[model samples]
Structures are given as structure tokens and as C-alpha cells.
Target: MGGSFKTQREVNGLFELTDSARNNLKNNAYYNDDLAPTKLDERTWGTYHIAALWVGMSVCIPTYMMASGLMAQGLSWWQAILNIALGNLIVLIPMQLNSHAGTKYGIPYPVFARLSFGIKGAHIASIARAIVAAGWFGIQTWIGGGAINAALSIVSPAWGAWSAGIWVSFFAFWALNVWIAHKGPDAIKFMESWGAPILGVLSLSLMIWAVTAVTQMGGSVGDILNLPATYAPGGFWKIFLPGLTANIAFWATLALNIPDFSRYAKTQKDQFMGQLLGLPTTMAAFAFVGVFVTGATSIVYGEFLWDPVAVVANIGSPIAGLLGALGIAVATLTTNIAANVVAPANGISNLNPQKITYGMGAIITGVFGVVMMPWKLMETAGAYLFDWLGTYGLFLGPLAGMYVADYYIFRKKTLDLDDLFKGEESRYWYKNGINDKAIWTWVIAGIFPVLGKMVPALSFFSDNGWLIGFVVAMIVYPVLMKNDTSSLITPEEEEAMNEKVTG
Candidate 1:
């Protein structure tokens, strides 16, 4: 039973629960300090902060590898950059749509899902996001560790020569990431606000270095850049369609869980304008840098060096090596904490908000990251792009569609903030805290992508899994939701509930 609040307050379309309401909700199993809505004063992230967040997350090793990965699949340098731009542009629509709910309601992704997926059933979205985030957390940690190991190796010959040094660095870096994440969202915001500028400078410096090195080696950066496609196994569309899907899938997870960051945003315009200015442009620009640098690598080393850490390590000056190593470390750290840590920490905390604190959830996420053995996941460019990304995009894309449809079409962009925290007493608490309509809709939409992955005949569906899943869920969720009023509250009902809580 929810208690009456002493007063009502709304800021920039975000509802802030009064002290009375907060106290009443505090004892509920589903309610926890970490999972609660942000207060009016806490919503301080403006356009620059949100934009900087994207810049920090986008300029990572994975973003750096995106062009090289596509090139490995037989795309020319320009083709890869264009594909990355288009995919990011396509994904930005859903990213912004999902972000609306976060800014408007001041809720994280799991709590936002409660409107459509029900209370307990929201786990479907949260856990799915958590699984994907864990893998990414591991991959970034591994890359950061390699950078740290490289820097340490320069200082101490014995540490560099020791067979176990790399493992030592890996675990040490992993612990540091978990520790910093446990410090909470403010720590993350501080890192991103400060780290974005430094990363931008380092990325540009690397690109310039590549061009100068290639020229001095008496090889043409222009010639390497002009090189045509080397290995399109089936043809252009065969490589392209999947490459586009993989690129979209790269950030598809963020599309669903963006609220984790956007909840801190000050206004809808702040989040929207910030995301528009940040995500696509930074990704496209980074892809170009990656492609150009890799091209220069071919001229300087006579072999394609896809890994940026390896490229930085190859530079002879010990001081330059240290700086490059630190740059990679910082880039990986900023990305991992913002992109990988937040989703799972918040999602897993949704599981038992009473017992699992956000910091605890973050530590648990780190353990899961290690257990996933991300080294295996990064074995090859082909496996990373096609196998891992394509497979996950199959399910996540539909999730974005469902979240959009429920928020925009079915609910008309309205949510009762107080009821969202209730247990069996709430309208969102359908059928033992699960929405059968949403679960069934997700399964039905996901089946096609799953089949496509399994059956070679339906490989087109798998290749374009994210778009397929998104469209199917968009079409299906609305129809199912039309007749199912289980989660819907009429105007009268909403007014009454608001009065009850406020009185």
C-alpha cells in the first residue's frame, strides 16, 4: 500500500516524489535507494555533459576497431566509414526515443520497462542487457590491461619479461575499473566530462603520427587509402548488409539502456540535442581515423595492424610509449565505466533492490565479465563483428522497438511515477508482477531472428536481425497492447491515483 504524499513537485517534466512518498515506498522489496528516481535537484546534466558522455564512450578500442573489422570483411576504407555513419544514424532514432522516457520520468531503464514489461518481468530487459554488458566489460578490461602491461613493461624489463605480468596487469586493471565504478555515477560523470577532451586530442595525434610515419617510410598513405576491396566472399551486399547490422549491433545495447545515463539529463531538449550532436558524428569521425591509421600501418609495417594498442607499443620512444599506453588505458576506462558498467549495475540491482546495492551489482558484473572469457570473444575480427554482434542484435533490436511502441503509442508518453514503485497494488503489477502480453510479444518477435541464426536459408533475417527484430516488435506490440488494458490507466484512474498519493 502506497502512502499519501505531503506535496507534489515536477521539474522539467520529471516528477519528484515527496519525502512522504519516498518513505512509504522505502519498505517495498522492489524499492531501493539506487533504483529510486532522481530528485529535482539531481537532474543537472545539460547538453554538454550528455554530449561529452557520448564522446567518451565512442572513442574506444572497439570504435577504433570498427573500420578495421569491416575492412576485414572486404569493405574499402570509404565504404567502412560510410557504413559506420549510416548504422549509427539509424540507431540514433531509437536511442533518442528511449532517452525521452528517462528524462521525462527520471527513471532508469529497468524501472522504465516496468510500464510495458511489468515489475518482475522487467528482468527480461534488464538481465538481457546485463549479459551483453558483462561481455563488453571484460573485453574493455582486457584491452585496458594490455595497455597498462605495455606501459609497465617499458619501466621494468623483468616485469615485461615475466610470463605472468600480463595476467597480473589484467586483474589489477579489472580491480581498478570495478573500484572506480563502485564509487557511483558522479565519479563516472567526472571521468567522462574530463576524459573526452583528452581522448579527442590523443586520437588526432595518433592519426597525424600514422600519416607522418608512412610518408617518412617512403610509402604512400594515398596509395594505401586508394586500395580497393580485397576479399568480398559473396559480393557487396553479402558483406555490406551484415556489416551494417554488426555496426548497429555495436551500439544496439546502448540504444536500449541509454536511460541509465539520460536519467541525469536536465531536460528533454538537453538529452535529445546532446545525443544528436554526440553519438553519430563521433563514431563516424573515429572510424575514419581508424581506417586511415590502419592504412598507414600497411605502408609503415608492410602488414595491417588492426589493434591500436599494438600500434602504440611499436613506437620506439619509451616516453612516447608510456603516453600512448596511458591514452589507451584512459580511453578504455572511460568507455567501460560509462557504456559497460552502468547498464548491468543498474539492471542487476533491479533483481533484488533490497539486498543488491548498485556497488554490489557492479562487483558481481565484474565477476561475470571474467567468467565470460572475453579473450575468446575477441579472437578474430570476423568473430567479433559477425558472430558476437550479429547474434545479440537479434534480440536487443526488438527490445528497443517494444520500449518505443509502449512509451509513445500505447501509453501516450505518460507514466504514474508513484505507482511505478508499488508492488501488487499497482496497475503495472499485472499477473504476479509480469506482463504476459509483453513477454509473449518479445518471444514471438525474437523467434525470427533466432531461426535466422540457426537456419542458413533464413540468413538474411539474421544478417539484418536488429532491423527485423525492431520492426516486428513495433508492429506486434501495438496490436497486442490495443486490446490488453492490463497496464493502462484511464484519465479518471490516473487522477484518482495521483490524488490518493498526494493527499
Candidate 2:
């Protein structure tokens, strides 16, 4: 719409194709409507919208439960909040780096992977992220269903007595998520923009309610803050290392697939500033709320209730319980659609872009979510931290390392827009559309962490798997890629190529 190949150009760091390039690639097997590079005019997300996206994602039920899990491990109230805050700051570096490629190229994560992973080989990176995302999708849906079941029990005492009602609510909530994701990206953007403010208000209200209830019971906020550490393993250093690693792994999935959302961002500053302002602050604040409320429960109910749904049910006022459930539902919906649904939907669509639509990929992701049976994954706080988060960290950290090294260090942030979709004709079509070096680099970097999990003497490696994997990839990928300049395009070369495409 803007111009033909003769007049096409870059705007605000974004490289968009002309009508000729679009027409030339439209019918290629690797091309699809969903996977196509976004036009310049399509990049509508401003700083506020990007910030709101993070706010919507960070203020969720699981984030609320994070401090409780950390405290159960060995951290005091202050230590837990500090760890949550610090982990987010560490992850922000990688998050910002990955977001740059998306905003600059207007390509999704799968397409971005093609820079280092090759065309077909990009699947290894995308699907690994998708699997983690699918698991998260199930966990969020389960939390939402729990909220729905809680509200139903309040409305009808008979429903509370029926054990089968929870399963019914689970599928109903699951279907709602799949339907919304099927509607596509605009639906998610609308949900996040509107939901962010409401979620902030809801979180503040819950915190106030917790504080007020505790004060009325003759317990002070100071008392909760001063709570002693319950379970310390050896000492603080032993617990701190793994806890920090697990906290970083909390958002490890999003760090890899961030391009899925950042592709819509208007500029580098918009995405950079928005995430900087949104992610760490919301996470720390919500972690504080979780620690405070769960601590108050020990005083108010004579037992600690880490689950917000259970806490709301025990309030005994039907109206209050219903409102609480609605709040949880909104929080979970905002997080599930953005964080869990988008990555897998785009990643699976990459597998067969011609035949598989974004909507179809979304439905498949939802089915996988149900099959994961996420309830088993949430048995205890310790299990959730050490087993689930730590283990996934081992895999995703190497991915983050490889992506950052390739985009920032090796290629120096330049990509050929037309060659990306050229199939065998594209430079990325390495060795029949697969890059063996990237695949081996990922496997090599991740192996140490996996071994750490098995060997008792190597527990340090397992506990800090995310750090280990990331560092290894950072060192290994460049050495393997040093002599291979096939993918590297200089700025002068890029200008000449542009002229050729225009002529």
C-alpha cells in the first residue's frame, strides 16, 4: 500500500517489504498470512500498549503464588521478594535484546530463529518453546477453572458437595481460552489493553483486604514481615542460587518467544521502555502481596492458605467469594492468552505454514494443554520450584543464549528480508533447510545441566541450570560459527541488495 519495489524503504528501524517482494513470496511453501512480515502501518503498538501487555502478563495467579513457593523453600519475606525482583532484572537484558529483532524485522519468533537455526531447523527452537508454553497454558487454565469452581460452590451448596463439578468447570474455561486465541492477535491486544488497568486495581484491592483483615484480627503487618524462615537447606547461599535460577526460569519461555509480541511494537524505545517499566515492578509488588496475604492467613485461619481461590472461599460471604473468583478469572485470562497461547500458536504454524493456519495451531496447542494434565505439576511449592522451574530452565536458558549471541554478536543485527522466505533459494536454506551447527550447539550447551540433575556431586550445575546453559551457549555457538559467514550481511551489502530488488 505504501509503495512499489522502486520506492520501498526503512522507517523507524523497521524493514518492511514492497509490493513486489510480497507478491514474489506470497505463494512460497514457507509463506502464510500469519507468518508474513508485518507491514510498516501494521506496527501500531505504542509504549503504553507494550507496557500494558507486560502488566497484563505479570499480574497473574502464578506470580501471586511465587513468593509463597520461595518462602516454603527457605526464604524469609524480604529474601523472597528480593529474589523475585533480582531474577526479573537479570532476564530483562535478554528480553530487550530479543525484542529488538522483532521490532526491527517485523517477523515472529519462528522466522527470527531462521537467522541462526536455518529455515526448517528453526523448528527445534520454536517447538521447544511451544512445549513449555503448552505446559504453562494448561497450568493457567487449571487455575482459572479453580476460580470458576469456587464461585459455583458459593452460588449453590450442592455444587460444592459434588466432586465432579471441578472437571466440568475446567473444560469450560479451557474452551473459552481456545476460542479467544482462535480469533487471533487483535483479540489478545484488546484483552491486554483493557485488562491491565483492571488487574492492577484488583491486585491492590486484594492486598488491602488482606492487610485490613489481619489488622482487625489484632495482627500487625510487621508481625508477618518478621516471620522466621521455616526450611533452610544448609544455609542461604545453597538455597539462594537455585531459588534465583528458578525465579529467572519463571519467565524463561517468554524471553525466547518475545518476538511473537514485540513484532507489533512501533519502535525499539517503545518496547524497551515499556518492558523495563512493566515487568520487574509488577512482579515484585505481586510477590509482596502474595507473601503478605499468605502470611496473614496463618493468623486469621490458623492455617496457611497459599492458593488465592481457597482463601477467597473461606471468606464465608457469598458475594465476596464470587467477586474474588471473577478477579482471578480475569487475571488468569489476561496471562494465559498472551504468555501461553501466542508462542505455541505461531511456532506450530511454522511447522507447516501453507496447510496450518494460526487458528488451527492455537487449537492444537489447547489440546496439548489439556493432555499435559497440569494438576500433577502443581502439587507443592517445593516441587513447583525445584522440579518444574529448575528443569525447564536447563533447556530454555541455552536457547536464550544462542538467540542473543546470533542476533547481537554474530550477525550484528542484520537480516535479508526477501531471502527469509525464499525456500531453497534463500541463504537460510542451509544443508537442505537445516543448520546442524545450531542444533548441536543447543544440545551441547544443555547436556551439562541435564547431567547435573542426575549426579549428586554435580547438583550445583543442576540448581543453576539456566545460568550454566546460557553461559555455555554463549561460548560454544560463536566458536562453531566463527568461520561460517554465509548468513552474515554487511550494511553495504544490504544497500546493494535493496537496489537490486528495486531495479
- Model 2 weakest lDDT span, ten residues long: 1-10
Model 2 bad stretches (over 4 Å): 1-8, 490-492, 499-503
Tens-digit lDDT string for candidate 2 (331-424): 7887799889888998999999999999999999999998888888887877777787888989999989999999988988878877787688
The lDDT of each candidate is 0.85, 0.84
Q: For model 1, what is the error of residue 446's alpha carbon versus the real structure, in angstroms, after optimal superposition?
A: 1.5
In candidate 2, position 217 carries an lDDT of 85
On the 0 to 100 scale, the lDDT of residue 481 in model 1 is: 82
Off by over 4 Å in 1: 1-8, 497-503
lDDT of 1 by residue, 460-484 (tens): 8888889989999988999988887
